[model samples]
Target: MEAKKAVRDQIISNHDIAEKFRLLADLLEIKGEASYKIAAYRKAADSIDHTPEPLSTLRQQGKLETIPGVGKAIAQKIEDLLDTGTFELLEEVTSEYPPTLRELLQVPDLGPKRVKLLWGELKVGSLDALELAIEDGRIYKVKGLGPKAIERIIEGLKSLKGRDIRIPIGKARELGKRIVQQLLEKTDKVEKIELAGSIRRFRETAGDIDIVAASEHPEDIIDTFCSLPMVQDVNMKGENRCRVMIEGGIQVDLICLPAQHWGTLLLHFTGSRDHNLHLRDLALERGAHMSEYGFKKNEQLITFSTEEEVYKFLGIQYVPPEMREDRGEIELSLIHQLPKVIRQKDIRGDLHMHSTWSDGKCSIRDMALAARSLGYEYICITDHSQSLGIARGLTPERIVEQRKEIESLNKELAPFKILQGIEMEVLSDGSMDLPEEVLRDLDLVIASVHSGLRQGREKVTSRALAAIRHPLVDILAHPTGRIIGSREGGDFDLETIFREAARTGTILEVDGDPNRLDLRDVNAQEAVDSGCLISISSDAHSIEGLYNMEYGVGTAARGWIRPQDVINTRPLDEMLKLLKRNRS
Candidate 1:
């Protein structure tokens, strides 16, 4: 366990070093440094970020330069970092402009150049200082900054202050998958490797990645894991446990146990913390002490090879990981009534997506073919409406043309249907972007707020209510207009909107874009409780984006959404019946 933890810490340290270099590069570029010089630091940071082998091991072996993009100078910097946890150049550069200045970049509209200007011209050294400058008219004096820019900056600062620090679950899952895949390929000693913890539970955001593996040769597995590409530092390398920080500053913990104890160990580690405690209390009542290795009952050790056996031994129905949040799941398990959460296979269609008609990269035919390939029965082409001019939102004439295109594709594809839809923007002051005539002609309509999202709570709520009340609107896409980790959702009473959606028969969308994943799990659950149907959509702009449905499914599972509660799970004929616009 100690060794495992050491490996984890080392990985984190590696990531920290790489981040410092990235920040240095950013600062240098802001200072008008030569492009090549800035590129060199960025390249080094990228190589270090993605390198398979630990930098320490490479440095000790005198092979640091063997890594792509790491020349002698960069190699030397790595050595310095390994020796003292930081390089002198970073210290020198950061002294001129405090490293904390980088936090300004967290503000939505504040880029490196603007941060640089604030730092250099106004001497704004921190977020508080920047706020002061903005309030005192100093920010307006800066070239290119106007009253509107100042207002946006104020909003951005507020968002930054309120933002949570954890990484989005999609990013955490991608990192975990990469690590698990590499571990499987690099080591034959491992029997099974699976992600555990909040990531395994499909939380909307995760603090780190936890993995459990069954292995006869634990040391070999640990060694292989610490050497995989993207392992920045190895903080621990214990006999049966390893912990490393991977690229992007996410911690990954690998705990290896004998194959017989895989189920017990996995359950113990894949925890919400509260859930595990409740389980432990229950175990005590059964005269057993449960732990990662096994259950202890009267000096006898009981271990299971499968999770079902483990759950059965505890006299409870199997609880899916996503429902292990201790929110009545324990009670449900006792009664054998755990909800059958929605799964990827249950999704029959993607109702909210875009194509080349608007901002999407793929053509309608290409998108249709991709959906067909994915075994989806149908897909909706929800191009942007004219209000979103930047996305090339469609004019009324264009909507007619696009509907004709959809009709043609439906004929060509036969049974694989293409549903015509529009992601019409909800304008401020409670109005729909396109006329009801245009919307009524479409197979589906997804109303969303694209601009003026920073409006007051009542205004935003009113805008949402107007869309929901529109008889032709089938769904609301990314209802909150939030980009995970970047911006906060518009201030609106979600429960009010959810209740209204239920009344109007308007479905809510759980956009599958990793960056969006709007209708976050908690809010989705609220919508579900309010009896609103949901549509798990990829919102795919490209063929590759179609795969985002998996993430959407994960989010739905987290929200305890079941197949019946999601309209997209219905077959084409059934779905179309629900989608029929109320012409009255």
Candidate 2:
């Protein structure tokens, strides 16, 4: 009875519920399910995911069906999942398509149809089998599996190799913050707490979480940390440090020190190893040795309460944590010439987002209200264009209607403008989806490659370059098309694309989606270095997603992008004048 009660009491978050639906949708698609059925499941999943309230609460209130895209049938499925952890259709579906096949979906460029083809034709049912097929060159014979596609699969598999060990930066930070919050709220004697290490540096992925704290009673804090509900097992405990395995097998180490040592401790732990080595060499040059406690100068100990003080003592400008990758930041700091990277507050608007008109969970007014709450001066409703029907892409007629709605919202929410825009698809032949006349009159046009991402490098490059050269197009969104751990970006000559964008005055995007920080840091830097203007945007699909701007800005900062480098940082009129169509 107690076990059953505990099971019933288990908290299943909205993300958990949504993931099941999404996985079911993918598996059903691989089973050759009807297009409309697959779309319904995916849509329901998106709605559930974006919902701010807990579905369990909604279910208790019998309001699950109230969610957009979730009808009576879907509501029952949610109830079944909540009650017993699985539903009949999910069980039946997994039987038809081996659950293992779902793993293949994680491989880049291998969507449902491609996975079905490989499974049916090559019997590539598992990652090992798929790898063997690739090794034996058997995948080459699969009708739709081209050489480029196989290369992407190879790269995707390589990325997944160690994925289970580390979490993405967004998830890691979220978890890190939660742990820190719990400690501060529940524990005693913790004077200062900060997340440190690679996570602090805003790396794309993190292995273990590092947290540093300052306290006079370090042992009390360490004990409380080890006993937290999230800590699965305490691996080691010392006077000043404790290492524990958290709920998901993620290792977290808490290093507690005297309050006076925070500056040096944070600097030592928030390191790239290479960065610390450089700092150590610099300290040696000054007749001192560095440690987490402090620098030692001629048998005297020096400590600081803040990072800025430590840098000041070293006679260098303080390097932001995101720039602490030892990528010549120290040298630049010595010269007092570090780039003033773009910050969250510097952004004036978000230009690329979706709405209910095109697979977004929120209405235009709801999305606009959410943006207004974030202090954004403006946002462009760049819904997917006509060719991408899966997203309910707007037809020319629908776009005309959308403009009417935008104009209404712009007036209602006076001063918070909504720019009517379209995320026009760059089709397989390098021709854009919308007619030129339709695209020309919009407030903004974002040309993106949504299909045929597996084309060879030259073809893909041409596709992208053609879009960049289009006079109506103002920005190239998520130029790489990579999904972090899930997929590798398209193979394109980014140098050529960047160069072309520079010449054409087309802006390149540093997308803020955690999963698709396309034009990843290195590429964003290269794009900027090539003299291309940048736009940092949260390709947010829901209001909660608007917060993803921080991730994008972090990526841009790592690339050394400054506010002046990002066009959206400018005021609305100046920003308009900078767009390709408006540029004199």
Candidate 3:
């Protein structure tokens, strides 16, 4: 148990150290430091972020510099962090500049350069100070400050003030996974540990994390959980349950029960509250009282170790956690007709991803190898078209060049195919960036709107419709270009677009990028109902990004999507046939 705690502690420490370095980089940039120095710290932070092994282990083995982007100096800094939890350089930097000034950077449009200007000239060290400066018109005197910039700053401040406190589901899962792994390793008498609540259901955002464990020694389990290094505040301590606010200010509740009552407790706690209520009503129809402990039938209590058994006792088929939202699962479960929800394993390939031909960090062959590693039979290299120059979008000549490269690589990587494709941008006037001649030569085309998002609904809808109706286009990438908590998606009639997509055999992407899970759960559900085929794609730029397919599958499951509803669930030949059908 002690050893397990040490591992968990090490993971937390590594993340903390990386975050501090990142903050220091931002601070250094604000201090007008050399660009190379800022890049060095940022690179070190990125290396630490991507390293799978614990920093402590790497330090012990003297292999910290083996991590990509980590050099001798950065490796030494990591060692110093592990040893003293602080370093002299970071201390020296923070001493000169109050770290609170970094908070101003969180305001949108306020980069390090602007922050440095404000802090140096007007002594604006915090959001409140900036707000005062803006209100008093003193901010206008700063060079490059104008009416439009002031308006944007005010808007950013308003957004920060009203920002949602809930954490994204992906982040919640990562935290919950770490905690569950530690508990599984450290607890002696534990039989099972499962995450419950909205997190298990794969909601887009979660209020807190709930964990249920089956153990013979409940007291010991509670004690170990409360003692975890991440626990910042213990709100409640009891025999069977303990509630703690973790390091990130997210609350987590741990419930320990005997193995016999594990299933009922998990089901009860893993609920969309309304779904549980509906289940209880169904139990009442059978003259049974349902609760977390068990179901009471005529003065006799029945407890089950498996969720399937509990569902059988209720005279219904088992409902998947993601489908436990009270949208319609109860009615389907009652009739034993619940849809076979799509699982991560059902995915055969990723249809939308970037490569070095555009903005991606990895090369075409490297991306292909990474996809193959994930058991994918194929992947599409959907690099941006020439309109998105910031992403190094491919010109027509470059597209032809990339196609030849893919063809050569495809011959070498035989069974694993790399489908030539482009994420062609739809211009404001409803025209695609790439010409028909170039698009016709590709195996797949993902038509997307990358600019002019502020157009009216009619303009946006017409633009999107043109792309959907294009013969060469296969999928609509991020039908709505939303970044959760950052920006709202473009205003277009989604239902109208869904209808056209269905008619044209065009697929709408359920993009897997955590920042842009566009055609989000609700929108995905609507598209499915409209008979539009959906593609759950990662839009991966790096190898690590490929794993984001799991998050996409979770979103699809939340939308009640079945395996058959997702086009990528089909094998290579079938997917190609469908793509061809769309073209036809």
Candidate 4:
């Protein structure tokens, strides 16, 4: 009886509904269905995934079809999912094909057609079976499976292992904030709530989410948290603690305590292992012991109301969460010498962005307007150059046309300038894609190697160095060309690149796109320490993308990059003057 009740009450979220649609679409494709049918399901999945209001709420109001791309049929399916936790189309498709067959589609280069081919040819329906096929050399017998393709499949499998375990910082923060927002909005039980753990530390990726909440009634808060609509299952529940598996297969632990212990609880959970251990040693030296409740000294528990108070009690400076990585932060805090790392508010402009002139979704005017809305003083329009035709790279004539539009926009949006720039590609043989005259005429030129990313260390390093040495080049964007977990970054002699970049007065970019975040924290630290100027940019393709700058700022803070170390944080005139073209 209890098992049946549990099954009936299984939580269903928008993400779960969207996943069902996506899997159904993939199954249709693998089954050789009509292209339009597959496309409809895919479109519906995207729309459902992005819809702000819960589909269950929409169903209650009989307005699910109001969502874009959600037709009456899709709405009915969604309603059925909300009511019964399963829909007809998904069941029908899963019966025809082993549900695990869809998992193969996640491997790079193994699309629905390849998955179909492998399944039909080798009876490979799961990752385990695919591995066995590879081990027995049966995979090579499949048509169109070449040596290079097989190599990519192997690497993709390895990448998936880590990808499955760690969540990108951007995704983790979004999930964490959503949970916090929901908890605050839905119930009055929570007095204070904050994201803790690695998400708090602003690491590039997070293993899991940890949230600490303060409330006079701890049990009520924990119960409310475990019952959130996004929670898929309750892993464990205690009087003051609960662990839940959220919609996207990530574990979230919520710890509730009395308001008086908020500071100690947050400090205990927002740690880097070594950072906390160091604090414990410091406490012991002071004839005290520390725990989540407070410091125990002379058999008395001394608690703090705020983190500042806790730090003051310890006779040390309050360390920012991102700097609590035990990397000389404690020593620096003791001496009152901790660097004021760059913050999001310190940013004045974005030096890298795209517009419809290239493959960007927004127009130059729209992007400029969006940046201005964010209180940005200026932005540079750095669309792709001609050689990278895949992104609709602009020709020399197109560059001239774009400048006219930028000039006109600048007049309309006074005090909010738009600088003309190009993301000029570095050819395989260490040559500039656009001519010197065209590059020199622009307000800024960002050189990057997009095509020859896999051309080995020496050749790729030479291409990068040539671009950095170019007098017209002012910044290097996404220097290593890494796409986080999916692709490996360029194997370059970064120390040499940093030295030359500093000497040539070229700034290096820390791309703000969560997937990119190139010149990641460690690299940014080494570059700034080596005297290379760094610029944090969103590399945004749309107006909403401009907000990604916070992720870049987080990465910068993790690297201990001060405001003076980043060029975009400076005033418009100072920033332009520092560019290679304006420098004497």
Candidate 5:
């Protein structure tokens, strides 16, 4: 029970961390100032709890600095928390408001700005104060807070008794697409509309909808948007941009640009801010002015009618939204240029997937047919092996049957190649689920440790190396299995895993599952540095999950993976040759 309580406490603390960062980040974004830096902190805090080493343990060991993205300032605060029982930065921030204000900020529909509004404008700092202030009818009169918004705020406050569904990026995109379609129907002035930022790049999770539209009449666009069924409250109204709070407490930004400004608007709103900033600086250096209106050289404005023109004027061939993160792309893009974006057609096959034979919701035949229909040249049906009983792992008998089914399916669909495979479990003893004979027969093998996750560093390194060095293993999937907002897996020396994987001609998978975008961007870069051939797989359990593969691709590109570096980008014949050549 004590252990349970400690776990509960830890979970609560993590919740606070995620909530504060998100709330603060949103407030900073809405205020439209220093957002990228605040967003970096929020993104860093978002990833920390997913890290295996307790931020506490790392801080205690004076190694919080080792975590990617944490940096010295955050690390020092983490260290302070380890030495004391509280986080100094959080404590200091909360001190400016009331402690309860921090808790109140967690309520849906409320943000740091709202709390700041309540504190500064209304002299209401805490929930109790807000309640009293609301009862007395004072909060409704603030500059940004009005009656309808306040009423919705209180409704959200009351609804906190129930849980709201936090949606995935794909689902949010579907909803946003629906909204775009509706607006398009309402006006022919709607020249272009697309999701920008991380959603456009297919991030797993998302905060809000960023909708940009190029139009003839901006007022009609705003009217069409506010006319949408999702909008519950219009927070701010401007000719160019409008912030509307939607149902489920999700915020959506509708930016309407004159058709002439569409290119600049898209380029600006589609920003990975670091990338935009560097581009802005570059425009300055080249005696060009860069703005949402487009790039200008000298005193004259050079606006693009399309995003392509914007990039050309900036002298970058074009930087795809996925590659925007200011991670040294500017320097490379300046030297020799590649195509601005990766097309869906470029992917030759879906390399990592499960079937009904394992945890997947579909059959091998169904998945293969679906992939073929989607223009894939090949599909590998990799079921989990016996060690993962929960996934209905294939026993040796099942493995034989599975191969027969694949072979039969291949015969039926003669043109499309089928790779018989297993997401084999690498047991704690460093033995594989399928013995040597079964592994040799397989076209591809992925060995992953799903259990014994508590084994410390050396054991994890050994298990990973054992999997990589084994003659049959081809790729290691979700090596860490660290789920976002959940328990973390043990630590392995990633440097060692990459070195071993490289030497063994094994690939390391960057899992695309939103909940488990394992071997995250930083680790993927580390793998690249180690000369490991990287593969981005959805680790797809469902057909819908397969679509999330682009998230892995996006994360990979952010880590600077070129087309030549990813294995699945290979055509069927070449991929087969590579696999067979590396077959041990």
Candidate 6:
């Protein structure tokens, strides 16, 4: 919060309003009430996130209304928030929703309509009341609240109240390490650079990343940093401060402090926002400003050079960044130890990719290039089979032709390995898209159901079981085929499928596409408990899609799956050995 630093108040950009609008849309949608209104907000918000020119500049040019998703109403609201820090419409709707009620919407089972029902008929407005209703059988007493819905609600509440969204500490370390590598290549002013947050301690997914740097020459650092090709925007920049967007769209704040204060700066920015806020409150009790910069006690800025120093000033042990999300880690770490998360370097391969043989915009070679650029040792090209004809599925004969193309590409990729895998269809009869003859010929085959989701659990499980038992089905892609809210691919009974998957050594996929983050954390952990190996594969259909694997990797960690649980982390020879062994 330095004077030279960019403040949110000074930001005339539509990014802030746009972000809030989308979050509002999510809240409205999950509440399952006023969907069109939710859609309108979301459309407006998405346009802002994707805007080529900053809204700040655009408004001055008087062209905000010209954007496709931005109509006059949304444009006017954007202008209002840009000029002032409030949205009248959002405020009005939110006033009807108290904090506790808002939190309930996140549980997934109870959206806005249910919230209204609880508020109107059941006279319940908060989680506490809702819990009471369920315990008292009042929930089921309400109309449309069936036994199954009640059960789902109870479990959803448990999930909501429990410690949610954990990542493998190791994977966090990998991303942090890679960021350090990128930093080294891009900036000479980085006399020191290290992953300073949850990633440093190895968590599954990082809420945010902190890059600590010490350099006598910060101007050189800023110059090199903003000039780096991947530096998408300068969220903040100064001789002593800089932040930029890196690959995979992650925001990295590189703080240039006096080498002596490097540790303190690292601690401040490396914090969980919630944790820091709590610490700030604690500091207020002690008459201090506890911030990412330092603890400003009494009007004077008392600075620390290290995280340890800052923690000492706050009268606490240096809680690692991963545990700083205010999830009781500040108190827990004092009593016992915590589990380590996985890092990206531990990832050995990129699985669940696509080629021109399917819906992928890229050919096999193009996908390989993008994967290799990420330093992956191997890539799986799992194109769609003929049964999914709409996805330009490959016929059995064409798959043979693809094999020939793969062999030629394999030769060109001297050291790197590219596995020829097929995303085969799980036919309605519980048979695979390719016959045993064709399936056995490949290194890996991921069987998935593209249709028949409406058949519900029993038939879905039967089809999945058929695929799992198939000698050649090495992995199951996007188990449950969940398309956000619109489609549920087979409405699979995951526990049953996972139980079968472990016995057959078939991997369950965590499809990386944001649209299909299937094998979701809850189901993924079940698969883990069932002793099923999982693949956090980017069901990437093109070269651009290869990067989506990071999202899958993050989701995998949130489920607490270590690098070992994911087959894609195995080296080329070992991964191939396992799949080929399964085929035999």
For model 5, name the residue pairs that clash.
none
Q: What's each prediction's TM-score?
A: 0.80, 0.87, 0.90, 0.88, 0.69, 0.55
TM-score of 5: 0.69
Candidate 1: segments with Cα more than 4 A from true spot:
1-103, 109-155, 158-162, 580-584
Clashing pairs in 3: none
Candidate 1 local lDDT, residue 153: 86
Between candidates 2 and 5, which one is better according to lDDT? 2
lDDT of 5 at 237: 89
Q: Which 10 consecutive positions of candidate 2 have the poorest summed lDDT? A: 1-10
RMSD for all candidates, in order, please.
7.9, 3.6, 3.7, 3.8, 18.5, 11.8
lDDT of 4 by residue, 82-168 (tens): 777678888898887998898898676677888888888998999888888888999999997888888878777777765647888
Candidate 2 accuracy as lDDT: 0.88
Measured by TM-score, the strongest candidate is 3
lDDT of each: 0.85, 0.88, 0.87, 0.88, 0.74, 0.71
* Residue runs of model 6 more than 4 Å from their true location after superposition: 1-290, 295-337, 485-490, 580-584
CA deviation > 4 Å runs, candidate 4: 1-14, 17-51, 55-99, 105-113, 162-164
TM-score of 1: 0.80
lDDT of 1 by residue, 1-584 (tens): 56545544554445566787898997787666787888789767866766767787887799999876679988898876766656787888888898778778778988877888888788897888888887787888888677787788888888777766687887788678877877887778888889899888877788888999998988888888888877889998898888899766778899998899988898988868899999999899999999998899999999999888988987899888888889998898898898899988898898988898997867999999989998899998999999898789999999988878888888999899998888998988778888888887888889998778878999898999999988888888899999888877799889899999999888898988888888988889999999899999998877777888988888888889999999889998888777638423
Superposed by TM-score, candidate 1 places the C-alpha of residue 410 at a distance from the truth, in angstroms, of 2.2
Cα deviation of 261, candidate 4, in Å: 1.7
Please identify which of the two predictions, 3 or 4, would achieve the higher lDDT against the true structure. Answer: 4
lDDT of 3 at 480: 89
Candidate 3 C-alpha lDDT tens digits along 258-290: 999988999999988899999899889999999
